[model samples]
Target: MTLETGAPENGPIMLDHDFFRDPHPVYREIKKNGNKPTEVILKTGMAYIPPGLKAWLVTSYEDIESVLRDPRFAKSIADAMPLFAANAPARQEGGGPGRSSLLYDNMANNDPPKHTRLRKPLNGIFTSRAVAPKRADIERAAAETLDAVAAAHRGRDGFDLVQDFAFPFSIAVICDTLGVPVQDRAAFNSWVQTITGAAGPEELARDAGRMAAYLRDLLRAKRTGTEDDVLSLLARSLDEDEAVAQAYALLAAGYETTANLIVTGFLTLEADPQQKRRLWSDPALVPGAVEEMLRHQSPFNLSLYRYVTETTVLNGVELPAGAIVFLAFAAANRDDRRFARPDEFAIEEPRREHLAFGGGIHNCIGKHLARLEAEVAFGMLIQRCPELSVLAPPAADAWKVSPTFRGLRNLRVGPVPGISETGRAHD
Candidate 1:
């Protein structure tokens, strides 16, 4: 497979707004190139990565798995510092070429030893057994959020599922676990939005700093207090900066991704009536359905920046050290090699393993909790509001404009034809 670089004859595929809205077509096109690592440019004005950053994109399931599992493709951001230092635009004020907030000092960006050490403090907190007891609370939260939506939109045709149900419910679960006060959620979300949104480095740095400070204060409170939440555990187990970083990491990583899973999963099911019927027909299928939805419309479109630790040839393409690489989890989940009829959202596909939560060591630590949350949230929704249906296709503005994450900004929903608001079918 040939690697296209620097304005190839056909030009590098632009990850523009359209690509953000519907990337599968491009994913298919990329796969047509023999599933090799294709060079893609992160265009100007995107979130996460710096503008004009050229990263090798791996989409095939096997190739993505290789990058994710291979030690050669490292997560240590320091390995790519010189690359960023040369390519990134000069930052104003508190921001610089490679400057980022301390919140990023967590394990996700580190290589082993440091990564292993930083990951240990909060390792067991999100396991299925750990999160099982919280199911009742999660269900109640989901129920209450839906109830509020119904009340606010009384006699109306619709309410935004993303804003009314998914976002608040998901964030609340993570925040409550971290012992963040209910009143502080709004400001906390604002800071997180700015940090994760398509803002310049200066804005990202500022908001990230704010979030880091907030986490530090919360860690301090948890240290002296009797709360038995995740933050409290972190405070006790790690030093101040590391504890604060981990707390921010949990909040940042947990909330929006889970929220996206819910919205995107629902949308995917709605678009496929057969799967929707299957899900409602078999309540026992909820867990498997969650996996299918995760595979079908992965919350995270791409993996975090994995720097090439050293020169290595992957899929016949030679990747030099310090090159930025991204494993396209969303694309890999739908690769036909690993999954039969991969595009179809089949809960009974038999192959339950997908790269949605990633693979290898740095796989999501909160995988169990995320699954539990989605299961409880979707289970409650299916049981309580089976009549709910999207009123219209999401507008262009509805898709969040982020290079790293894929989710709706809003999704309007209400009872569908032949189904009453009480969830009973009409005669």
Candidate 2:
């Protein structure tokens, strides 16, 4: 895979079966050899992007951090895409365009000034400082979901934890956090699924439109005012479209990633029984265990392409403005240069910092909430079901279909669920 010019060569490779089965090997290949501008083909069905786009990937840990922190890397998806720009208007002082959900100016799709506007007011709500009150909600959600799993399994050997437990648990927490009314939850859940679920670009765009419209209406209602919920606070701070985007971010960030973390963390523990037993023996290690799980199975394989906004060079590699680049978080997380046995899972791994939450300014907003959710969710699972085990060996197709997202499509667990000594669940 070396270049003929005695330099490294990168792709125009298709994100095919081998990639879906395991992208890590390709990530390693990119890490070892790729240093110049290269193209990774993305099909339209892969995501909301109308596809056929080329993305240059940066895989080294240092370079990943560099690009994420560098202000020159554009976050506006509209800026990276001309198709989006025709529909999306200028980034207004209050918000960017809401022409399409795919092109909507959410926090993930904006550089600073716009990003700061969308993110600033929501920070206090999503902070560790705010996690304590929701701790009870998160814990109850976890315990209750596990309880349902136990009830459904009855005398059975397994249940789909991904659907029955992890998915709704995260969705419920987000709904409660956003103060979406109990009556509106069904509609809310539909929108979340449409955004996060596997669907073609046309379907995703339609769903995104439906989601955007619903949120716009919801945001309008919130503008009349309430003391609670992130949306109401955002409505007061931002304009109509900006408020809707911020509200959308809450659902977008809160759902899929958190769900994947719970599922992935559980699967990781199941795979390494020795490590699982160690965590059970010393439950104080759960926090660190959560971190290790996050690093070991970073929910995202590649970051959204960061368009080079200016000519940039770092560590002797140069990229011109308008160049599309992606930070391979999964690759960087497992870089041997930075981590001790990069591929192995160990709770006490000394270097725990990872690009899982991304880095620098464009980092995830719901991260603290996500971490707390994982802690409560996985902690409840291990403490209650000490005998928890995956029913069937993981097959290749068990992984999610999306090239960027990595999560188990189905994680069936148990040899019959057990009640905790504290009465968290009963048969």
Candidate 3:
């Protein structure tokens, strides 16, 4: 799926299934036709102006870094009124209220003062001082998940790494940390699906309304209850509306992205045997491995939409006010100028920054938690489930379509061979 552009003009390009499934080939083609900064418009009328969505797409690492850190490029989509108005019906109907509020005005969604205010309290929760105590508990949870998988499979046939391992593992850890009631797990899981899955506009609106009603009810109960949970913490800290908003934010932030990382990390490790072996041999490398995995397979292909606050020139391309931009973090991670052997997945590569969790003030607040979760979860899997292998082909080969995330819908795995009923493997 190569897209050939002539002379790098700014115009909309039809986004076919191939482009959505695998955008790299098209990105390379666009690069070939255009200069350093190019504007590749999507058929949906959304522009892919780089660095900031309002400007031209910054393909080079230096330019992307500069744009990401630059305050001139506004992160607020509300700034682009005309664009938002044009897309409002679609946007509103597609995951309004409970589902979209998390990304709409939470710390990650806002810029400057608003961002700072929202991020302050949440940031404290993820710092080393706060998170260090949870490490042992996290490790124990990971081990317990592996034990459950082993018991279920009994070293026979295969198991789904995504559903049976990563999904449940992440959910359980987050639930335990947040103190969500065990009885609500089923509803929470269903709500997450409605929020993240590709539902029709009407369906999305319906789901959002349903989720809001549910959360409101849950909040009311928590307000009168004796239990201490994340909801309770937020309730005590913020007003009712604000607390409910934070509840939505936590759900969106806590689940999908981590699930994508866990699934992609496993697939990447399975695909590259040498890297996997290195990870297995050196437990200390787990953190680096997780970072590299985050870089190599960025869960969010596109950053949140940002509108042009004013006319701006990025990398020699002029962008007008109200222009929509999508910072392609996935593309930036693979930029040759920033990363040596950018295509390769090497944990041993000297540490360098990547925009996997984004950059600037809008960088992920839960980064530490995500990293801790991945390190513990992946390390446990490799150590305990030594025979882990891909249940399905790579995502590119499978070509599953998702709007905001790229992940295998299903991942299967087999246990290490030669293990006895007592779980001892014959060498």
Please name the candidate that would achieve the greatest lDDT relative to the true structure: 1
Scored by TM-score, the top model is 1
| Residue 117 displacement (Å), model 1 | 0.9
* Candidate 3 local lDDT, 1-427, one digit each (tens): 3433222544644444565566667666655654355654443222111111123445556666777776767765345444655433334333334343433445555687766665665767767678778888888777666666766777468877777777778788787877677787767777666555545445555665666666667777787787777776765665565566667667766767788898887777788888888887788888888888888888875666676667777665666666566677777788776777878988887335888887777777677888899988877776776666775575554533444566666776775233333343311
List model 1 lDDT by residue over 247-360, tens digit each: 887897898899999999899889988878888877788898888888888898677888877887888777778778888888998888888788877876635778898888
Candidate 3 vs. true structure, TM-score: 0.84
Candidate 2 C-alpha lDDT tens digits along 212-295: 788878878888975567778877888887787778767766778888888888778888889888887777788888888888
Residue 159 miss distance in model 1 (angstroms): 0.5
For candidate 3, the clash count comes to: 5
Using TM-score, rank the candidates from best to worst. 1, 2, 3
Supply the global lDDT for candidate 3: 0.65
State the weakest 10-residue window (summed lDDT) of model 2.
87-96
